[model samples]
Target: MLDRPTFTISNVRSGDVVSYPLVLFDGQLHGASAATSVTVSRIGADHPRLRAHTYTAPSQAWPVALDTGVFKALAFLVPGENVIEFRAGAEPVAAIHRLVVHYLNAPWDYCVRAVYVVPADDPVGGFQAPPHERCDIDSAVHRLALAMRLLQSALAELMHRHGLGRYTFCLEEPAQARACPSEGGYEEVLVAYGVPVHVHRFKHSRAALQALSGDELYGRVGQALSGAPDRESRIDVALMSFTRKDAHTGMLYGHTALGGGRLALFGSGSMFSWPENLEQVPRRFTDRTAVDGRRFLDDSAGRGEYWALASTSMGAVLHELGHCLSLPHPHNGGGIMARGFDYLYRLFGVAEPQPGAEMQAPDEPRLDRSAATRLRFHSYLIRAGSEPHPATLYPPHPPPAPDGAVSVPVPSPSPTPTPPRPRLYVATNGLPARARAHHEAHSAPRRPSITWQSEGVVRVSAPNGLGHIGYYLNGDVAAHEEFFQASAPVHLLDIPWREVCRQCGNPPAGAKIRISCVDHAGQIEEAFERQVGDRP
Candidate 1:
């Protein structure tokens, strides 16, 4: 067993930067076969409390010199005494550490910063350095810092596209740049990506991040920090920690939403790899799932469903922000309003931008037309001050779905730009529940061109190997469902092989079918004049 480490905290006058030293004395105190990262956070008893203020420069060994980022960002530390808390992973390691934040008295001007690309160095199969060898702890910390900065830049882009909202990124691993010695590469990464970094502890415990409340989370951070000065405003904040476990592949790193509308990411050393988009990262070439997934989006391992990486990784972020905007995914196609379908590239050869790829000057990454519509739909859900929690953003009510899916297929040679339609969803107590795809009928049918299938009682198709199914409903706008009053054409996509069922519970009677869809803008629009005839 290792002796518990002790530390203190002191208050600094506002507008000052403070520094501390982290020492690991026990020679027997060895780092887990992976790199060990640490961070310091402020724990106050208020809404959105427990803010991570400093991330220890990542390292493989203990007892390293400590210069934290949080101190740097808040250049206005007071010279008084304060108690800052120290957390290893997400758990509290040392509470109420006394520290002094002294003013540097240096004049520093600020400007809009951006994220640039950097190269990375490979580390061992795991996060830790080989035992006894000079562990490259400094490089690791710097690398993590750079990654945080880059993500911050991305968040800015997201904010510009969506409305201004406060959010934060939580870390799950020891982010490092070089091995033992900090090198130019690590420096490059830090300078290139300008975001904050945190050392999040990895754990399966339900009590993880017990320090931070729901209001302090991203969804509610804006209101919590609303009183802060504008120049010192932060759009994205990051909280991170680490963990120790015997397994390698047991959910090394993954992100999930907490009940209070908070989101956290957990990962092991093997799960946290050096970043490729940043420079001089000391990461191993091993195929750690988390690292591999991140790496795939990085410089190496390019190709083979790679878009899946970008889509899955960044798609959730987009979706979450979409919810804040009161928007839903486009429901005009054969997919639900919640699922992501990249039709721009699939049809028009307009691929999503590659990670770290640059756009023309003055042009930042903007949501496509479809994505824009989906985002706007969320406007209906924004309750503002109704909820006590800062991050609590929920839909006003559940979407209403009929007995079956009413689909309108996109015509062959897919339309240059898809139109909007009404979508039906399952209603929860008169409120909207999870929305599903209503049938999408093609303006015209093409034989043997594409295939479709009905699963979970919904007819849909597979896009890039993802099965998209829509439900058949009863009260469509054309068919007489309450609140549905539009006469829209119905269609299905890549029509799949299936048996005909009765329309509204009678013998299959309609040579023509009507479908409902939710437009990109979250409106309940409909398409009519669809023909569901017998195929010979």
Candidate 2:
């Protein structure tokens, strides 16, 4: 019998940090006469979870062929250490190769000092339950703990996608509220339908809580904790929880500084409504299992109203923390940073029939490639002991040419304005009717339609000096190709459609495709097209 094809992992080894979204696995399937299949799976505790299943044609299976076989896996690694296994065939045709992925710098660590703010009259500050009777602060502490856990999980997933590991969040002992004078006295509001003002004061009042800007609060906390000898061991994150909204903006969530040391504030009222029965709060909040070293709170339980509340509250907390980590809101679409539960559903890849459930949480939130890249860059700076600056991370767009620098056009001396260099066009197949209609409706006349196949192959013929070719989906660069010398025809056949769809907001069927080319002189040319395909 002919020898079974031999498969090996060529590009990555046991410990390697691959880029986010796309991880290329280069290997040869020897002695294969026809197309063969390969499987890439993430090693899990119970079983191997399939990540990608792609086939290679005969012409591309051998190393001697013009196009060597390479499998691209879309990785969404969790933070810390993640293991992925590769195999060739449905039944172990090749020895499994294991890869360890890390999402953060190995020695990076930070501690979060949680401060629970309560009314001055309250005897004991911070989170404390009564000896026998239920306490009012039970729900606040429960939600805060749950939110922190979710935030850690989301950050881990973001780091994992980029292949860094060992990022941790240590929750320190809760700090007591600092006594501050009440602002403007209390304004009585009606409670329980219509009640006497005197009685309403006992139940609820619109008394403003003393407010301090995030910067001011951070300084105060830093001074209060200055006595600790291990101050330099880890970065400080002051997680201040309050009973009322910020007096200045009425905003309940905000943070100051990102990386190094920072302060994140949360208003309990903004997180969740108080439960009528304090017993409703999950006992797991205080469970030993909830606090796992640098990792805290567990999302193991799949049921209960408190879980849903915790999940929703956690979303808010995670969103604010994202800011502290230098992540911006992708306001254009749904994600943790976007508005509403739509982002949560999309993150977990679930549809909620009953949107009112108090215990719904995303399985794991995901970061787009751009956001992931930004976070990785900031994390690197933090590990290197530098404060992150927006200008340093993302340079400002070039300013328009100054008026003095603009040269007046001397009417081209040639009577015939040098025949406009023949309009360059990128050749591709025609778009489907639906895609064509969508393009015609949304695109401008300057953008031309180019045809492309489902395999992500695009043909281009350009003048000499072509330095690079870029393929974009919905404005985001999806693939890049570099050329040493200009050639008659060039093809970009490695655009990972799965990742492209993801970056393009995972359109239902039709998506906008654009091709941009930059010549050696830096002159840029582009063509736009649309395609309809099954969801990636």
Candidate 3:
């Protein structure tokens, strides 16, 4: 209100609580021109709690990218309290003020570990570095650390956008001999300024890695990164950079997969363009420079290859992580489980260098509603104290009227590992769309314990307290997916035809959709396959 270049932080106000270490702050300035420079620096900050830990380092401020008056600033905050200052224009220019955002590290135990998988044959830790950068372990560590931080912030933002608070998976801090600062016996961490990455040299050489198939690749990562698989505590992101370019032919073998349980592998081909430091984050997003076609996977959207690699590498890892968490619902709807992660930069920056027709100004990537339910109730993501007690039993959900929900009576929640499996019932009312559940007699024998339900019109309910509804259609590909939360208003998770078509796009002329509903306790009973098009 007072100066020519009015600097204001819109996303987060002064004294608001924030969780992630590296945060993007978006704001506006009316008076300043497009080229006006906006620099951000911290005046003074302090971390009262966990003060003794050596990793609780100070925060750093970075320059803001101001485009046509609207600007985006990046800042790093310590655990307890962080004060960030933003100044618009040059030294003597108008509107330079300081703002503060409280930093409260989320209280979570299960952590996401950032690990760089080094091939035994290579000793120097050679990896493709950003242009004119070093290809060493230190550089790999910085690149991986930045990617992990971006992933952390992106999840937090997406969950918040879904009306759920800033809930996200925890990232492991530096190794510490001392116990966590939590009051109870739980995981307590402080996300400081720097990215802490672990370099694990695989006993197997590059030849072994190249020879391994997808399953073999996942198995290797599990054996190396995930120790004592039973009730594992940490989820590891195993990143590798194994690329070779020669005269005749080139080979880039990225043994990437969404390994079950605790590990996910990622290839860092575009990491050279990734920000090693906090300041370069803005510049990295808008980098339109083309990438070596033979060396890396071309993930660049309408923007340049550098940015596409950043978005794809990071988002692709997250997608795999989602599968690792047992949320492998079919890639339907424009969600993280789908291909929505290409515009990951939109979550942080207010603008991109060159925008395509589909690329909007402020649209960001996110997890769909069904995926949200899965993440919220996932065994790993559940907070230490917030876990459901086996002894406690919830009441039975009211069954649907004579139309959709059929005669099968629902059961109450139980503590047993394998409780009574839920049954599938369909409504053939044909009000909206008709998907009739075949009577056991007419139901064709497909596979053992498999039946075909006329999809697009049906009532499939998972009465179990915690449930997930999945559809694997067109052979291996997934069509529509759904999940029910433990705190859902009604346990009868209805799958209407109208909603099904909306959630799952049009299937081919002839495709079989295998629908499965599994309870959290590993009980699977309510399931069948649906045949689309004229019955063959």
Candidate 4:
């Protein structure tokens, strides 16, 4: 019916060379109400697993309705050029437009592996999900893989927006990649090549998994993957089950976020709500589905429902992945690591689906300057002796990249295997251009049971530009406090007895105060732990 370019792709332009495999096609269908669909087709690239175009939306076979005129879809690219076509109202098509994107798994060979951890006794290879959010193991694999791609694009965009270029985590290839239970590797609809999701069957039973705490499972999972073929090269992104131990409380197990030395492995609960396919992805973000508290893990905690659940569950994984890359929680900002990852939808669509769920004057999730600076030096995204890719060079403008971060290499059209590289981001022996060290000593301190200056204020400060400070109580995964003084490294605070108590309930007796500092060089330092207050 229509002959003009009725489709407009936003996030990217045609002929742009991208480094990552997964790309979110953010754009809108101009004018009127009619059937619309986006199809991915290859131009010159030939991948063993990748076929022509496997992902399509709002199709007769499986309808994934788009958002009004504004819509977004995920496209996994082959080595060379990729052509994504948009069509509406079928044949000769109502309105059509096509865009091309590129990917070369370049200088950075270190990739994030999407791993599915299954207990030996589980039948369907399924975790807990409310009836409204049920998907089989095969489906779960597709969902997780899709989620990783979305995250990859989100990160690339985050870094790019901040003028650091589009750098993101890579995925394992056909060699080390493992397919889920269903087909060997159909990927989503099982027709094209999709990033491999490694499946690891744990020897323990579901009950055993449930019995372990988050930390315990983190260690167990890390140990399991420690014996991997090339353990030091890949950062494991693992998925496991979490079940409620007490019928009265909603506490469950199997949530781990520990990453160091090629080991950033974990995800759980809200995964049930994770979109199972590209079509369902956007909808999943705004998914207003109520999580049946008794059956599924409520990751939203009350901020929102399925939409919030998806954000935290998926975003949390990315956050932990950051930790794996040596990224620490920043001092004061809602960036991904600082718990403001709810804007993943913002990367694609213009609005939120659920009523009252819309984000306004948003506290968006991002990779703040400090995070960008740190990741810039990370070995995972850059090579020590590599030069920058001509096509994707950073724009020499304001908000420049961290020093020594301008030149980075893009993968060749066909990815090649590089020598094994260590996961550590900071150099061990001799120091680099910039040197940083952390020191903490309480002034006029009391005995072992004393912390705090009788005044309620924890002091913190940072170097010229370093910016991630964390406060913890006793020994817990969640940081009870974070002081983000990017310039001055000192900010007073109420000792754990009062301030932290407001956040983490009554900590244990003689609860100790711990602080962590991560500079812009990916260096991590755990400050001294000072005990605060009485044994209440």
For model 3, the stretches where C-alpha displacement exceeds 4 angstroms are: 1-4, 46-68, 90-93, 97-99, 175-196, 228-231, 245-247, 254-260, 295-304, 329-332, 355-364, 382-536
Q: What value does the lDDT take at residue 485 in candidate 1?
A: 25
Q: What's the TM-score of each model vs. the native?
A: 0.26, 0.33, 0.68, 0.64
Model 2, 1-536: lDDT tens per residue? 34555555543455543212123344555544343444555555342322221111111111122134443332335433457665554343353456775432212223443434444344332332222323344444444443443344445444444443312243432221112222422212111101011100111121323344655545544454444323433233333333333445544432232222344444343333222222222222211222121112122233233334344444555565555544445525445554332233222212232355523644334554444434432321121111132123212222222421111111111111222121121110022222322332223432222334566644443342344555566654554455532333233224455554554556666666566554322234565455648432
Give the per-residue lDDT of model 4 (tens digit) for 366-464. 876656645653445532111244334423221322442222323321122233222222222112122212211111221012234545554443332
Please say which candidate is ahead in TM-score: 1 or 2: 2
| Total clashes for model 1 | 118
Put the candidates in lDDT order, highest first.
Answer: 4, 3, 2, 1
**Which candidate comes out best when scored by TM-score?**
3
TM-score of 4: 0.64
Q: TM-score order of candidates, best first?
A: 3, 4, 2, 1
Candidate 2 global lDDT: 0.36
Candidate 3 lDDT by residue in tens digits, 1-536? 33456677765656555546666677776666643556666545343443442232244333344545666666666654556777655545566767766555543335677767667777776676534766677777777777788777777667656544445676765642122222211221223334446566666677767677667777766666544222245677777756333324665565454645678876656667677766677777777778766654555654447766677667777888887666554454576777777777666665665666536533357787666645644434421111122111111232444644323222222111123343232121111111222433113331113233466445554343335555666533354343332234224454654454444465765566655554432234435655565452
List runs of model 1 lying over 4 Å from the truth. Answer: 1-192, 198-239, 243-370, 373-536
Provide the overall lDDT of each model, using Cα atoms, as 2-decimal numbers.
0.26, 0.36, 0.55, 0.56
